[model samples]
Every structure is written in C-alpha cells, then in structure tokens.
Target chain A: MSMFPIIMWILMVVVAFVIYIPVAIKINKTGLKRLGATAHIFTCDPDKDPIK
Target chain B: MSIYLGVFIGYFAIIIISSIVGAKKVETMGDFTTGGNSMGLILGVGTSVATWLSVASVMGVPGNIYSRGVCAITGWIAGWFGGTALMPLIAYKIRRPAVPTRTFPEFIHARYDADKDVSPLQIVAAVIELAGYFVFSFIQVQGFGIVLNRITGLPFVTCCWLFMIILVFTCFGGFQSVARTDTVNAILILIGVIAGAITVVNVAGGMGAIVENFATTTAPAVTGGNPIPAGSLTSTWGVFGASAIMSTFLSNSLGASVAPHWVARFMAPKNAKTGALQMFWVVIFLIPIFICIVIIGMGGKALMPSLPEGVTSDYMFPQLIINYLNPVLGSLALVAICAAAVSTANSMLLHCSTSLIYDIVRNIKFSGGKKATVEDDAKTTKVLRITILVLGVLAVIGAIQQWSFLADGFTYVYGAFGSVFFAMVWLGLYVKKMNRPAAWVSLIVGFILYFYCVTQGAPFGLPTFIVSGGCSVISAIIVMLVTKAPPVECYEAYFSDDPSEATVAAMHRIRRDDV
Candidate 1:
C-alpha cells in the first residue's frame, strides 16, 4: 500500500529493460553473421516447427 | 459448478490437442530435447514466460504477499527480473557455439572436458539437475493438486493424480510439445491474471481503498495468530526483515539465472539473437503479469482481511475466486493456475528425463565412444519418455506429502542450483583460464557450504545460496589462479566470436549427431 514497493518494482523493471534491450539488439545485429549457416539447422517452417 | 467442470474439460482438451500436434513433428532426439533448436521469437518468448510464471509465481507469490506483505515483491519479483535481465549474456554465449550441446550437462562436458569424455563434472551436473528438477516437478504437482481439489471438491490425492496425468501427457511428447503447449498456457495465464486483478480491484471499491485497507488493517496472516502491526504492510521491508527479504531475492534471482532448464531454453531458440531477444521480451511481458499479481494480493487483503482457521495462505487465490467472482470468470482464473502448473511441470519433467537419459545414462554407457547413431537417438528418445512417466509417478507420491510452503520449495532448490552452477556455468563460459580442478573444487566448495548453510543455518541469517554462491566465486578464482589453464579447444566454442574450423569440428564431435 505504501508506494515504496511499487516504486522499487518499477525501478527493477526499468533496470532490466535497460540492461537487456541493448544486449538483445546487439546480438540480433551481429549474431547471424557470427554463427553463419551451420547453426541454422531447423528451417522456420510453421508445420514442422512446434509453434506457428 | 457445471460451468467450472466444462471449462476445465475444455482446457484439458486444448492442451491434449496441442501436444498431439507437437508430437507429430518429433522425428529425432533433437526434436524431443531442444525442439530441434529452431524456436522463433514468438514461441521462444511464449515458452520462457510461461515457464518462468510457475505456480509459485501465480499462487505462491500472491499467498506470500497475502501472508507476509509487499516483501514478496522484493523477494521474488524483483529478483526474478534481475535474473532475466542477466540472461541475454548467457543466451549470447550459449547460443554462439556452432555445434550447440542439446542438454546442459553436455554443454558442461563440451566446455570443461577437452577429451569430451563423461567426466565427473558432467555427471555431478546431471545429478544436481536431476535432484533439483525432481523437487521442482513435485512442487508443481502439489500446487496443481491444491487448486484442483479446491475447485472440484475431489480428494487431494485424486487431484494430484489428475495433475500427474496432465503432466505426463504434456511432457511425454518432449520439448516440442512442452514449448507449443506453453505458448497457449502463456496466453491463458495473461488473460486470467488480468481478469482476476480487475475483479479484485472492483470488489475492493478502488485502488485507493484497497491501498488504505491494506495499510491500516491489523489482520493476522494466519487465523488466531498475532495481528500484523498497522502500517507494516506498507513499510519499507513489509513484515519480513531486511535479511529475509534480501535472502529470498538473491536465492531466487541468482539461482534461476543459471538454472539448467533456462540454459536448455537458450539452446532451443533458432539463433543466438532470438534466444536473447526472447528473454528481453519475456521480462517486458512479465512486468504486467507481476503487477496484476501484486494487485490481486493486496486487494484480497482488503476484501477477506484474514483467512479461516487452519487454512494456509496458499488457499487465498482460490478462496477469493470462489467467494467473490462469477462462475465463468472464476473458472478461467482457476484454469490459469492449471496452465501455470502444467507449463512449468512439463519443462521440469523434460529436464529430469533428459538429465537422466541423455546426460547420465547415455554419457556413461557410451563414454569414449563414437557419436550417437540414428538407432541410438531412437532408443534414447524412447527411454526419455519412460523416464518422464516414472518420474511423474514419483513426483505425485512426493506431492501427496505436502512438504512445506509452496514457494519455499523453489527457494531451497534454487539455492542449491545457484550455489553450484552460478560459478560453473557463468565462469566456465567466459573464463578460459578456468581449469578442471577449478571446476571440481568450486562445485565441491559450493555444495559443502550450501549443505552446511541449510543444515547449520547460514551466517547472519542470509540465504544459503548467497553464502554458497559467494564462496563458489572466491574459490573458483583462487583455484583458477593456482591451477593450469584449460586447453584452448575446451573454451573456444563458447568464447570465440568465430571459432576455427578445427574447433568447430571438435565441438561437433563432442555432441551427439541427433539430427
């Protein structure tokens, strides 16, 4: 009921986003070239892959 | 009552159909274990969020908040967010390897054992995973049974067995089935929690009223116990002291970051970027779900004030639904709990079976041997299915006992995992100088300290995981300094941005040619 916990929760969410989003973006940009075709074993086929 | 039953039946039918569809695509061990390492962002995010929002998060967290106060937010939610925040680095490193290991233990072998033999380190990791996930699976079954028993008026044991059937059906189809069903479960959980939160806010009049009631109410957490002091629920640490709150946060967050199931999840993504992105998205999405849970917990306090005599706080969520909400909405909320139970239970069950079959049994049987033949893959897949069934029965037996508080179960197991693997996984992936002796010593030191903390009590009442994890890092650093560095080949797959052709070939040789 005190706003402290809510404030703390929001702070944590912000901290997580700040830490994760950049790393994710960097990985997305560089990851495919780094790993190349060898790692891409499964084709992204909806019928074959578990999730559509 | 009939509406609840119909909704439950419909939920189970949907889950079964999804499993059947997922099972059709499983032609090799890779499909069973890692969803053929082809998960797109949506599926990856779905499974990760669903698995993360275990019954502990849905039921235990609210119950903890209902009983203790907002400290549950710091102890569980914040720590979990921190853990997820740290996961992109892990995902990047883990998925970077050209030939990824299917299981966590296999990754250990591939990283630490230059010879790629079934080393003691791999066996120890598998054993820990087996023990940890077995406990995790038990907790899920216990939570599921508690909810279903409350809803159906069936005997508790009957509800547990019912959950076991669902768990086995979900897990028997392996990672593919688990991931597919998990996506559906994730959606249901989101809707259910949002609806429950909205209903709670409405019943309590408004957010302001709920907050005022929660702050001023002196309701005892358990009936006939001492009333909670007024304003304590709104205090900085809530009812729990700083030490207890910090311990809970550290144990849940740090331990979960390197948890084997999460590591394996990183492997399932289509690429390194997807793995990292999925976790980022999962963290974003869980923000709303956790906020709703907090609202539900606080609002329940405003409405109920205190629970009935002899009833634990774990019953708070279901009791609220039964007492306040309409049948249709209540049924949906109950089904969400079921979804949480099934989504998490299947992942843990898969980890248990895979750790047993692929990590321990096969690693030992085929030590110093060639890569797995097509026939070996077929045989291992069959054995993994059998292990899931057997373990499901064992978990049902364990659940019948109702060992401890629902969320406390995770704290203990996560402590053990974080203590041992926090150094082993994180340092092993990044620190090329870390040697076999360092790995063995850190594991031993961490496990001993963890055991001691659990048995004798941790110093200053800190969580066992914090003490043990600290010791693990210190000992690992000291040992790494004194011991010789591991062979270049051992760490190259994880550390190198672009590993040499020879190193890639070696990595390929270390893993089973499952596809």
Candidate 2:
C-alpha cells in the first residue's frame, strides 16, 4: 500500500475536523438552533443579526 | 431458489411491520416529512449512513475496484468520506430554527424569497431537486432489479416491478418509518459487508496472498481500456489517467454533500447536537464497511482472474457470495445489498415527494408562505404519500433496461445535484450579498453546462462536475459582485432570527392536533 494516498486522506480528515469541531462545539454551547452566528460556513441571510 | 426467497420474505415482513408502526406517528406534514425534526442521534446516524451508502457505494464501488484497482478508493470512497466530514459545519444551519424546515429546497425558498412569499428561485430550486432525486431513486430501483434477477430468475423488468411494490410499503410510513427502517437496514449492511469481506479474504487465501495475486494479475481488455498489466495495480491513474480519477473524486466529495437525501437526514435530527454527532458516528460506521468494500473487489480479482464469459465486474459481489460462501451465509449477505438499495431508494423517493408536495405545493398555498395550517398540513401529507407511490412506479419503468446505466447514470445524477445546488446552497448559506440574479444565473449556467458536457462525453476527459461546478461557482461570484442583494429581512429569516422558536415550543408544550 502506498503511504502517499493514506497520508493524503489523513490530512483531509484533519482539516475537516479542524473546521467542523469548533463550530459544532460552539453550536452546542449557545444552545441555539441555527449556528446563530458564523464562525465559518457562509449564510445567505447576511443582512440579519450579524454575529459579532 | 438459491436460498434467497425465505430470507427475503422474512426481511420484507419486518420492514413492513416497523414502517407501519412508525407511520402511526404521521399526523401532520411535520411528521411525514421531517419526523417533526425529532429524530434522535441513533436513528439520525443510522438513516444518514444508510442513505449515504446507497447501491452505488455498496455495489458500484466494488465493481470499480475490481476493474481499476485501489485507485477506485481514492476516486470514489475517499471523496464520500471527505464530503461527509464537512457535513457537520452545515448540519445545524441546514436544520435551522428550532421548528426545522421540512426539506432542503424549503431552505432555498425560505432564504431567497423577496416578499416572504413563494419566489421563482424557490420554485426553480425545488423543481431541480425533484428531477434530480427522481433519477436517483430510479437508479436504486435498477440496482434492486439486478439483485432480484440474480436470485429469483425473474426477468429484469418483472424484478423492477416487484421492487416497486416493496417501495410503497417501505415508503408509505413517511420520514419517521423511513428513519427507523433505515436503522435496521444499516445494521444488516454492516454485518453483511464485514462477513462478506472475511469470507472473500479467506477464500482467496488471506490478505497477503490476495495482495500478491492482485499485484501480478493482468486485467482483461474491456471497452474502456487495453488490458491492464501486472503491478499496474499500484498505479493511481492506470488507464483512466489523472483527469478521470480527479473527476470521480470531485463529484463524489463535493456533489454528495448536497445530495437531497443526505440534506433531508440533517432535517430529521432532534437538535443541532444530534445532527453534528450523527456525522461522527457515520464516519465511525463507514470505516469497516469501506475496508470490506476494497477487500471484496480486490480479493475477487485475485481469486477469479477473469469473470465467467458473460459476467461484468458488477457481479463480483453476488458471485463471491453464491460461489464461495455457504448458502445461509450468502443469503444474509444478499440481504445487505437489498438493505443498501432499499434504504437509499426510499429516502430519495421521500425527498422527491417532499419537494413536490411540501415545498412547491405548500408554498403556493401559504399567505406569508412561512407556515402551513393544520388542514393544509394534513392535505399535504396525503399528497406526499400519493406522490411517493406514483414516483415509485415511474422509477420502476426506468429500471426495465438490462444494462445497468448505474455507473454512468450515477455520475450524471451526482453531477446534476452538484451543479444546480452546490453553488446555490453554499452561496446561499454564507455569502452576504449574493443577489437573486446571481443565484438564478449560476443555477441556469450550471444546469445547461452540465448537460452539455454529458452530451459531449465530458470533453478532454473533464468530469461533468468540474465543468458544471466550475461554471456555477464562477458565475455566481461574478454575478453577485455586480447585482444588488435581496432585502435585508430575507436574510434575517434565514440567518439571524429564530423564526421557528415559538412554533417549536408550542408543538412540544401543547401537542396540538390542529395547526
């Protein structure tokens, strides 16, 4: 098995976790239904209550 | 006759019974469509994985691996894993408002409407979703036809009709039943694939021997390429070259994230935490199954050097099961393939129905177009069920052909969803000033460009996804920069305000039958 592809997969996973986990944790903390604010992932409704 | 009848009948009975029991919960559109947005983490994970693993992953991936080697994993499987990993970032947003949206297209309708009523963007988005998901459901029915023909010796067309009957019973229970039934299917798939992998590995004289044989085996000449030489198994881009591999990876990863059935799963979760956690568990569950997928395909190649005169790589799994494993065990494995296909087909059908009845029809009837009354909701539920039945029959008709257009059709289906929605959903979700014109232009361009590429064989070896997806993103961005955004309140409804909070609290507190 070439380690190159496996390593590339590992990197992709790491990046996904880095981007997703923090937002997930924030959503959990706010007790809010929507992300309630954008740490990341853009919202089409940008004109509304702008997250700090 | 080959040990499938008794097992399949019993399996179908359990699915029907559970689906009926779950159907008892469907008193309103909320119940039928999003399960009242009350799905627990367990069912959420189960349905999500079952929906994600479809016939394509279970049957198609193995076929690819058998023909093209490990590059299949990089091209297809890796993209799925990668795409799903990003789902958490959008899960909460997609399932927005404590009240939750019934379908994905509803989100587009909610976000982009100008007067807080139905808009052209909403209708167009829902129509695209309906068309795309309808085709997806057809492919799953075709997959079921393949398996049924193998087991029962029925004509392919007859098998397609038989599976269509199964879909009605399975889909009639609505989202609640679909989620519950999916849990059962997911468990079966996990067990079947794991067992099938172990049996394939052992039959081929262990993993090391299988690997040795694969490295030295020569591929038979097929329509796509010249015979692949020994040791070329290690080459990432053998006959397909870099572009083909990249195309698979792009469509599988990017296109999948927006697949209607997948987005529908997020809507059913009990809460944001439930949705977010679902992705984690999905990845956990998929790992073993995917490893098994690789083993089955690669191992089959090791043992059989060349398929029997008429067989294609698509038959590798069923061939391994029947020819190698004991009868009882093979029957159990076959159930897994059935489970994978049924779970995906039912979910796709459900989404298609919801888009037709819940998003499009319901939007037309509502004044603010934001909420549906109890009577209106009940009427839509009836419509949704009827739609599911009618769509099931249409899918059966699509499956009557002998050739499994699944491989090529799968790319077109995913690419269609990606081109039409990927830009719209992503931009609609994040970009501040993406105006209606931008959304419209991007959608139209992506739709036309994708079909054009498909018609021309994806010129220069470029995948349909890159052609369409690139057009969607680039055009949306360019247009958004020049066009004025929609009104600020439109943005608030989707992003800033908790519009569904009162309704959610009322539903939880009063349990009102009347809307």
Candidate 3:
C-alpha cells in the first residue's frame, strides 16, 4: 500500500554513489599533480596551483 | 513510419537532455574534456568497450562467418583478446604518477620526452594516431546514418545530421555523461541483439535448417569475367583466411587498448588494478564474435536469401531484424544499433576535439609569438564545447562522401601511427637506452612510408602495416645506434663495491683509532 519502491530506488543510487565517492576522490587527487596549459586534461602542477 | 526509427529519436531526446542538464556542473576545462577525472570503473569499461564494438562490428563479424569461414576471426579481436588476457598482469606497469597530467599525446610526450636522441618519433606517433582516430570516428557516424536510413523513411544524410546533433548533446555532458549513457546503451544492445537472434533462429527452424539452407544456396553461375578467379568464397580459408587473418586482426585490436579513449579507461577506478580488471571483462564480453550481434549477421544470410547482389553486406543484419522481429522488439534492437554508432562517434569526437584544442590549435603560436594558459576555467569549458561541435561538423561533412569500406578507411592510417609510437611507447617504459632521437627518426620514416603505402593500397589493396612497420622499426634502431648510447648497468655491474668492502672496514678501524 505504501510507496516503498521509490524509497528503494533512491537508496540504490545513494549506495552506488557512496561506493563511488572514494574512487572519484582518488582520481581528482591524481589530477592535481599534472601541470601545463591543456596538454594534460586533468592535471595542474601542484607547486603552481594557486588552489593547492 | 518505421517504428524503430521513432523509438530511436524518442530515446535520443531523453538522453541528450539528460546529458546537458546533468553535466552542467562541468564548468571547468578539465571537466568538459576528461569528465574531471571522476568516472567509476564499470561505466568507463562499459562505455569504452561498447564504443569499441559498434554496429559495423556486430553486423560485419557474422557476415565473415557466412562469406568466409574462420578468417573473419582476425586483428582487433585477436589483439583485444591478448590485451585483455594480459591486462591484469601489466595494469600496474601502466599506472604512472603523471597519468592525470596526460592526454594521449601528453603521455607520449612525457614517456618519450626523448633525450637529444629520441624526439622525432613522439611527434610522428602523435600525428599518425590522431589521423587514424579521425577516420575511424568519421566512419562510426556514417555507420549510424546507414542504420537509421534503413530503419526509417528518412534520407540517409538527414539521419546522419540528426544523429550528429544527438552526438554533440551526448558529449556535451563530457566524459561522465558519455560513460553512463553508454553503460545503459550497451546493456540494451546485449538484450536486443539476443532477442533478434532468437527470433531469426525460430523463424528459420533452428540451427540445422539454417545451416542446410546456407549449404544449398549457391552463387548464380559465374559470369564471363570470372570474378575472384581461382578462389572459392565457399570455404572459410579462401578470401577470408579465417585463421591467420583472425589472429592478425585480433592482434591489431591490442593496438586499440592504447588508443586515446580506450586507455583513458585506466583512469576511472580506485586504482589501475580495479580499472584493468574491468577492462579485462569488457574485452571478453565485447569480442566481435561472441554475442548476438554477430549471430544476427549469420541469421540474415540464411533468412534473407532473396537479398539482391550488391545489397551492401553490412545492411543484411539490420534488414533481418526489421523484417522478422516484432515491431517493438525490432525497435529496441534498432535503438541499440543507433546508440552504438552514436556513442563511438561521440567518443572519437571527444578525443579529436581534445587533441585539436589541447594539442594542435592551442599549441600554435601567435604571429607575434605569444601563448595563453588556462586563465579562466569557465572559458576553457566553453571553448572545448565549441571544439566538439566544430569537429562533429567536419566529420559529418566527411561522412556524406560515402567511403567504399569502413574497415579499409581506418586500418592503414592506424597502422602508420601504431608502427612507430606503439613500439616506441612500450619500449620507452622498459628499455632505458632507447633515446628520443631514435623516436623522431622512426616517426619521419614511418609516416612517409605509411602515407605512400596507403595510396598504393587504395587501388591494389596491399598492406600498409607490414611495409610501414618494417621501415619504422629499422630506422628507429639505426638512430639508436648513431646516438652512441652509453652502457647501461647489467648483471655484471650491480654497483661499485664501495671501493672494496675490506678497505672500508680498515678505514672504519682507523677512524675508531683517531677517535
């Protein structure tokens, strides 16, 4: 009678994201090490990065 | 009026809108170009593998089984098989500190930042690889056009343009959207293709009846010219060279693992190990011969016996699906086919866009000689999006020209780049003595020879690979020699034993005495 399936669908997506979060962090962590204009896609030299 | 065509467009609208809205967060250059280095293992592997295995591969593969026997089994298949099998073993070998900093060219540029000895090869590799990718990408879009035209009442060129617009929107989400959509698209293909295969087999009264039908079907008695003289399309070994060719073709696909988008698959997981494992499985599932797509092609040869001569063998599979499967089921399969074409072209469009903007266009110096760095993240995003559109347009224009063979269009060009950079990059990782100059010499030799061979092969259908590969390897070695390389440490020279361990001990005793 209750709308339980929608709750389950939301939970599944959340779980997938929870598992995926660390992997994304690792990729970003690696990207931070690269340096150049767009020669490299994700990287910016850490030493040069104002953000870092 | 075709049910499949309508369904395909319906799905296209949903996915494209989803892509643009979901990817709105990609406000930086990196996000637009590489999905901001944030794809999961499954999505990356799924999309990369799905894009690699396209409608042409799905249809063309089984046609090989029909027209030629085991020989249809060669190059990309064999290479991919070997590569997948070898993946886990070498995954770590490919994991480098600078990967995030690398585009395909950036990787080559760094890995082979050849000493004074090794520079030319890198440039050659870059140029050739880019060219190979460009042609393959163009054909992929064209393959979509063919499938769409066959299913719908629309003009082929119009279908191509419509699909091309879909392609841009899909890529508008950048790497993340592409991967997610492709993962869904691939599963749909697996299901649709399998359904199409079962229906075809059922209609034909199972495998035995189909085989029997195939055996009875003979060529209308040979015309006066005696086409393909002294050979039989009747056997697998004749024109197809099923075994040797199968191995060669599969071997060539190993070369794909190193392609720009494919290798980027390595960047999507917790680590290279996880990504490599995903790739390993993707290869097994996506083998040109394994699944329903290929089966559909064989089904077509049996079920559609009345298919006229010169009906473009590639169209046979789609024709069978449209005629035999239920309208809705057929529509699903058609969507899968269109999706396959669009996804691959999109991937190629992304790679070429990245290369042109990041490598070719941006690298060009001003008339007064000034360069700009990544000044605004938002601006960079806009530029890459524009680059994707520009490349998409160029490829669409090229697709309308109607090439004779999709497979033929890509191979020679890929081989040119593959011969030099493929060998050099692998060696650069392992062989310390190989200098940068050697890479350069090999590149010049490889590109010129490969270009010449491609022209000649156009008329004669000769191989560019063996010719270009042979020259590049020889030249690379010669340049290595001319550089007067130093003797690298071997088993004989582990280290200077600290000028004698005993002498060191004696010196320690004298120091103790002084103390």
- i-RMS for every candidate (Å) is 4.9, 6.4, 16.1
**What is the per-residue lDDT of model 2 for residues B1-515, given as tens digits with 9 covering 90 to 100?**
64678889888998888798889988877778889877776788888889877888888888777877777777777778877887876676676554455677666655565444456776777788888888888888888888878877889789888888878787888988988888899989988888889889888999999888877778662333456788776566655777777777788778878776677677777666567668866877888888898898888787666666565667667777878877777888888988988998998898888888766776676644245558766777888889999999988887765345455566667778888888777777677586778888888998898889877767777776888899899999999898787766445544643544533433222222233
Cα error of candidate 1 at position B371, Å: 2.7
Q: Which stretches of candidate 2 lie over 4 Å from their true place?
A: A1-5, A29-52, B114-116, B221-226, B365-372, B402-407, B457-463, B497-515
Q: What is the lDDT ranking, best to worst?
A: 1, 2, 3
Q: Which model is ahead, 1 or 2, in terms of DockQ?
A: 1
Which regions of candidate 3 are displaced past 4 Å?
Answer: A1-52, B25-27, B83-91, B114-126, B220-236, B241-251, B268-270, B287-289, B364-374, B452-464, B481-515
Scored by TM against the true chain B, the candidates give: 0.98, 0.92, 0.81
Name the TM-score of candidate 2.
0.90
Residue-level lDDT of model 1, residues B133-202, one tens digit each, is 9999999999999998888889999999999999999887889899999999999999899889999999
Q: Pick the candidate with the highest TM-score.
A: 1
- Candidate 3 lDDT over residue span B177-222, tens digit each: 6776677677767766777778888988887776555545543211
Chain A TM-score of each candidate structure, as shown: 0.47, 0.42, 0.42
Better of 1 and 3 by DockQ: 1
- Candidate maximizing DockQ: 1
| Docking outcome class, model 2 | incorrect
The candidate that achieves the highest lDDT relative to the unseen native structure: 1
Give all candidates' CA lDDT scores. Answer: 0.85, 0.74, 0.55
